[model samples]
Target: MPEFAPIHLLYLALAIVLEIAANVLMKFSAGFTRKLPAMTAIVCALAAFTALSYAIEGIQLSVAYGIWGGVGLIATAILGITLFGERLRPSGWLGLALILGGVVLLKFS
Candidate 1:
């Protein structure tokens, strides 16, 4: 793995959290009809992007964004299934596993 500062990792981690929060808020916002959730979603999205920008200063943008997006996508999928009772078929599970593999490869690349 290429070396990266702790602060860069911190920023990337926060970016993933903020992005996940934004997606969850948007889901609860129900097409933005719910005012508070809609506004919070907007804020989270902005913060996520801001953190991503900072992360790229130390971490390569390709690596940072790939990890950020992959992890966020995986977490969101889990939350959707758990909290919203969404279903995933065998194909979906395979896709998630592929994403996990890609993320690990990206980290070591």
Candidate 2:
């Protein structure tokens, strides 16, 4: 892999954060009935994709996408459970664990 500037990693992290915010906002949007949250979610999702684009300029696309999606999925699921009183079955937890493992493998490979 080519050397990448720290900024690229920062962009990837920012993308993940934005994605999480977008997901939370979308949940609060109540299927887009809530105008403010829905609009904010749209903005956040767009910004997240923009950040991901920037990140891929330096980071490998596979690596960046793996990390972004993996982290976002985990964070969203945790938030859903804690904030929304959502529950995941045993298989769901296993799926998350597998995703985490895949991310780690992708990063190292």
Candidate 3:
């Protein structure tokens, strides 16, 4: 298996973070009922997609997007658990594990 450079991983992680931030901003915009938040959401979405494209330069699109989505889901779940006091049952944990395992496989494949 080929190893990715640190910078490549950094870009990929940044892409994912930006994507998540954009999504969160979009949700906030829904509550504001104003144009400013909506405009900010559009800008953030564009930035996230641009970063994702940059990340694909050094990583396979499939692997990059898979890891991006998988890690994002996991992180969001954790945030929900901590901040929203959401609970995950055994089945949910199993599903999360499967998603993580898929991410590992996609990264190495």
Candidate 4:
């Protein structure tokens, strides 16, 4: 496997952060009565996807997307567990492990 340039990794990380931010904003906008937040959220989502597309130029789309999604799920789950006091049963842990294992396999395969 080739080592990714630092800049490329930065861009990829930015894309993921933007995507998560957009999703959070979108959820907020749904409960909001004003239009500005909703519109902003839409724009954020568009930008996030655009950034992701740019990152894909330097990385395989399958690898990028699989890592992005898998890591996102894991991170979000951890956040929920720690920040929101959400419970992760043994089955949930098993699922998370499976996802991470799948990602690792994809990275090597």
Q: Against the true structure, candidate 2 has what lDDT?
A: 0.97
Worst 10 residues of 2 by lDDT: 1-10
Backbone clash pairs for candidate 2 read none
Q: Which stretches of candidate 3 lie over 4 Å from their true place?
A: 27-41
Q: Which candidate order results from sorting by TM-score in descending order? A: 1, 2, 3, 4
Q: Give per-model CA RMSD.
A: 0.5, 1.1, 2.3, 2.6
Tell me the deviation in Å of residue 82 in model 4: 2.5
Runs of candidate 2 exceeding 4 Å displacement: 1-3
| Candidate 4 residue lDDT tens string, 1-109 | 7556666667678777766666555555766565777777778778767877877788888887887778767876776677558898999999999999998987776
* lDDT, each prediction: 0.96, 0.97, 0.80, 0.76
Comparing 1 and 2 by TM-score, which wins? 1
Worst 10 residues of 4 by lDDT: 19-28
Candidate 2, residues 89-109, lDDT tens digits: the string is 999999999999999888887
